[model samples]
Target: MGQVLFYKDLWKEEFWENPWELGGLIVIGLFTVTFLFFILFAVLFGLLFPSEQTENEE
Candidate 1:
């Protein structure tokens, strides 16, 4: 007999029975993590180096 694959819940549980779905999940997860880090660093940089407004002096 052949083995049957199924889509498992990643949030509630661990391990993926299907390779195709697991690959998709991994790719999406990586992209999500990258975006999260990018946003975090952007906010930190903005706060640390805020632009200043100045008027012309005589």
Candidate 2:
């Protein structure tokens, strides 16, 4: 039995030669950075201004 391969050579010149792949990679990178930035901002905001909950109200 032979094993199937699904991974491609990301560092290969051929990989970067495809405009579609390059564009997809750029989009993915931007999305990841934006997601991380939002998460960090939320965390900082929460830490800086935390909500106060009193036991008097449910």
Candidate 3:
């Protein structure tokens, strides 16, 4: 338990101080947002304009 707390504290103090960590975090955030936006746009587009289907075509 003590080691876990120490590591947690160390991470809190060190993680943000590293440039690579910050850059990696930023890249990850951007990718996540882009992916989410794509999914949202696709869903909205599908909802707004659904494809026409005929039962006999199947």
Top lDDT model: 3
Question: Could you tally the backbone clashes for each prediction?
Answer: 0, 0, 0
lDDT of each residue in 1-58, candidate 2, tens digit only: 1222334444466788989999999999999999999999999999999988899867
Task: Estimate TM-scores for all models.
Answer: 0.60, 0.66, 0.70
Error of 3 at 31 (Å): 0.6
Clashes of 2: 0
Candidate 1 vs. true structure, TM-score: 0.60
- In candidate 3, what are the lDDT values of residues 1-58, reduced to their tens digit? 9999999999998999999999999999999999999999999999999998899876
lDDT of 1 by residue, 1-58 (tens): 1222333344334546667779999999999999999999999999999978768633
The lowest-lDDT stretch of 10 consecutive residues in candidate 3 is 49-58
Greater-lDDT candidate between 1 and 3: 3
Question: Using TM-score as the measure, which candidate wins?
Answer: 3
Off by over 4 Å in 1: 1-15, 56-58
